[model samples]
Target: MNEGKLPEWLHCNKCNAFINSLSNDSRLYILECTHIVCKKCAFARQRQSGNVLCPVCGTTCAAKCIGGDELPHDVQLFMDQSMVLSELDRLRYCVQVTLLAQLR
Candidate 1:
């Protein structure tokens, strides 16, 4: 972990706001499509459009707000990574099951 600093690329996929530049209490959400979004843009999109969709992939598949804005940037980064890995695992399992079924 960078401790006092986060990578430059660590940002909301939509607004491109650097995580470190965000306020200490800035909310973030992890989209099911595995995109990270800041709460401002997310909620604004929701209010304007009636739902928060991934701007990058335009997926309303799902989104998760793991916790409030009080969480530290490092913690938020960890959660984002964990969510992505979990999604990948689920997808891999689905592909495996599909391939096995097709062989039968």
Candidate 2:
């Protein structure tokens, strides 16, 4: 999603970067804690905490919430890049095999 398209006020709780929801329904939520973090950040945070604190309010909240999911941009980008790299590797491997067969 385009960071420019996001509203001025909306930002990721951790990095303060633009929080772009994959879908229109996504939103930042405090997991019963005081902190209010974007879903993406919260997921990452959850991994560390047995129960993560709400970035907004610091209240301890369960892993599950209404939406209860983070859509971190970095994670998405990394996953995308991973797919691209994997495809490139596959293509290169195929080319290498073809070349070896032709030489034989």
Candidate 3:
């Protein structure tokens, strides 16, 4: 599908936020009727309604998450921080073990 520039007012119907078509960090799910929605909003709607339906067109469409590699910047940053904390915990454990051995 052609990734054309989304109109300025083309916001997610659920969240009412701009779809951020300019950023690779924002994921969007396009409905069969050409309506676009953000990933989070789409998932929430699917959970609430038990089916994915286009809010604008009232058409049932498959809600597939797009932009897997383009997750929101804040989310990506949080994942990075979590990984760093996990590594630090592992290193601290190793250091404690070494110090205990020396004391013994």
Candidate 4:
């Protein structure tokens, strides 16, 4: 795989980091809020308090799991779509800023 291309399933929504999803010793956690997070970030949040909130939605009911397979299909699809839209919006903002700078 290219160094700059991350597997879709390995994208962590919390820290925006690419993680190894296939490692047996990997410590990735999937939240009930449909957010994927690295173990280090999850633990850090928990250490700051007794419960860990979903970094994406600020929900306090997230459960730690290895994957998001248990989520309902509709929920999963919605999450994926939201992530894509978020990325597109960010790219659009960057492009707009670049164009404005050139015109100034």
Candidate 5:
């Protein structure tokens, strides 16, 4: 993920609440329209307006739209940190190899 991008994505698009900031029982839903919402708001919208629409793009979702394991905040954070660490390790290795090649 780009710098600060994962942080941006880990928030409910509707309420703008941080994913981790939500209650432990709260579930996160990712919309096909590339939006995300907390289960509370999702159910509320469905109960009130009788449809599951993307709060961001206003796109309609299928009847069972909230069942994806996609990019949970914890997993996304792990992945992002792993990527940065891997790149740093690679650069460190290159520097070591270059030093060894220089014979000094």
Candidate 6:
């Protein structure tokens, strides 16, 4: 996981959902454990403060809302906002990949 390189976005093993990569904006703030999740699943388990749990892996996280613990200034931020993916898109994308390999 080199910083500034493409983020390693992963699908959650538990719910079969794509996890989002953390963004610099998010890293600069106090949001914990950058992970992507489906909006529907995230909404269902949203915390009172509006934080969300990882839809796939069950990692607890805050929604777009920010506030929790801050990272140190010297630490280079590795998270990026660009890597988040919707559930349907993720599923569809995976299917396309599978289908393509089958054709080959």
User: Among all windows of ten consecutive residues in candidate 5, which has the lowest summed lDDT?
Assistant: 62-71
- Mind giving the per-residue lDDT tens digits that candidate 4 earns over 1-104? 22222245665677777664534344466676767777666655563445677667777755554533453232333235566688789999999999999999
Per-candidate total of colliding backbone pairs: 0, 16, 0, 0, 0, 7
Looking at candidate 5, what is the lDDT of residue 74?
Answer: 41
- Name the top TM-score candidate: 5
Which ranges in model 1 have alpha carbons more than 4 Å from their true place?
Answer: 1-9, 21-25, 47-51, 66-104
In the range 4-100, model 1's lDDT, one tens digit per residue, is: 4444556788888766544445655777788888777666556354557677787664556534344444354564465668878999999999999
Candidate number that wins on TM-score, 1 or 5: 5
Candidate 3 per-residue lDDT, tens place, 1-104, comes to 12333444456766687764545456666665666678666655463555676766677777643334443332222233556688789999999999999999
- The RMSD of every model to the true structure, in order and in angstroms, is 9.9, 11.1, 12.0, 11.9, 7.6, 14.9
Clashes of 1: 0
lDDT per prediction? 0.64, 0.54, 0.58, 0.59, 0.59, 0.46
Higher TM-score: candidate 3 or 4?
4
Candidate 6 on 1-104: residue-level lDDT in tens?
33323234443333544434335432212225554333444466777766766655566776542211343221223334433335457889999999999999
**Residue 5 shift from truth in candidate 5, angstroms:** 16
Better of 3 and 6 by lDDT: 3
Per-residue alpha-carbon lDDT of candidate 2 for residues 7-76, written as tens digits (9 for 90 to 100): 4355656657564454544555444543456666666656344777555455567644222235344332
Off by over 4 Å in 3: 1-10, 21-26, 47-51, 64-104
The weakest ten consecutive residues by lDDT in model 2 span 71-80
- In model 2, the Cα lDDT at residue 85 comes to 86
Which number leads on lDDT? 1
How well does candidate 2 match the true structure in TM-score terms? Answer: 0.35
